[model samples]
Target: MTNNDIFKKLRVALKLRDDDIVKILSLVDFRISKSELGAFFRKEDHPKYMECGDQILRNFLNGLVIHLRGPRPEKTNNKPQKKSNN
Candidate 1:
């Protein structure tokens, strides 16, 4: 239900280690240290436990998409080329 819970589940389901996650996040230009990432998976009672924020989750999801499907192709101009008198 909580963001942290969702993050934890996804981490397990994806079989992603901390290093893999860091690389995945980089795909979207989201920078995160392994220690900070670990904090999100810690028990709530732990002093270093940090709640996962929506921005982090959203970025991770976006990066994951790129990781699985590769980055989207660059957009191309749709207009017809103008004729030139050679």
Candidate 2:
């Protein structure tokens, strides 16, 4: 199946709206306009239909990972203090 098909199915399965999708894509530093996203959902025959590219799909998947599971926690450096004997 094409990337567009996969994207459309995922969107419906996740019950995601345009805004939600935009946010999800943004999670991975991918920026997309609402109108551009709408183009992906349009019927093939529609003049405004825009084919989903591999990069868009890849980014969406990466973003979805962060969306579903919260972003990875930051690492902390904790050094134990040395004891001083008088």
Candidate 3:
């Protein structure tokens, strides 16, 4: 299936509205206008239909991950590095 198809399916499965998608994408620092986002969901034959790019899909997935699972905790470095002799 095309990226558009996958995107459309995910939108339906998640029951995400245009605003929700905008927020989800923002989580990953990806900014997309509602009009642009709407283009992705348009019918293929429509004049305004825009093909979904890999970058957009990838960022959406990353954002979705953060949406479903909270942000990853910061790593703690308990071991100190040893000093090297010159």
Candidate 4:
């Protein structure tokens, strides 16, 4: 399954709104906009990630698992491109 599809399914399963997702991600130190999240959900691809850009599916799956399974020690193999903390 695609990242977007997985994300949508997870969100539905969790019964979370976009705002709720934003809040949850904030708790984990990952900030993203609702529009971006919507785009990710609407599109057939995962949104670009600052910490796991190269690992699109992995990044999304990790996020879903974290949301469902709660926070855990992060495991990242590939370095991600740095984005300015705007």
The best candidate in terms of lDDT: 3
When summed lDDT is taken over every stretch of 10 residues in candidate 3, the lowest stretch is 69-78
Residues 1-86 of candidate 3 have per-residue lDDT tens digits of: 99999999999999999999999999999999999999999999999999999999999999999999988789999898999999
RMSD of each: 2.2, 3.1, 2.7, 14.4
lDDT ranking of the models = 3, 1, 2, 4
Better TM-score candidate (3, 4): 3
The TM-scores of all predictions, comma-separated, are 0.88, 0.83, 0.89, 0.53
Clashing pairs in 3: none
For 1-86, candidate 4 gives per-residue lDDT tens digits of 65556667877987889887777666556777887666766543445532223344455555666777787877888878899998
- Model 2, 1-86: lDDT tens per residue? 99999999999999999999999999999999999999999999999999999999999999999999999899887888889999
* Rank list by TM-score: 3, 1, 2, 4
What candidate 3 gets wrong by more than 4 Å, as runs, is: 80-86
The alpha-carbon lDDT assigned to residue 6 of candidate 3 equals 99
Better of 1 and 2 by TM-score: 1
Q: What is the lDDT of residue 62 in candidate 1?
A: 96
lDDT of 2: 0.96
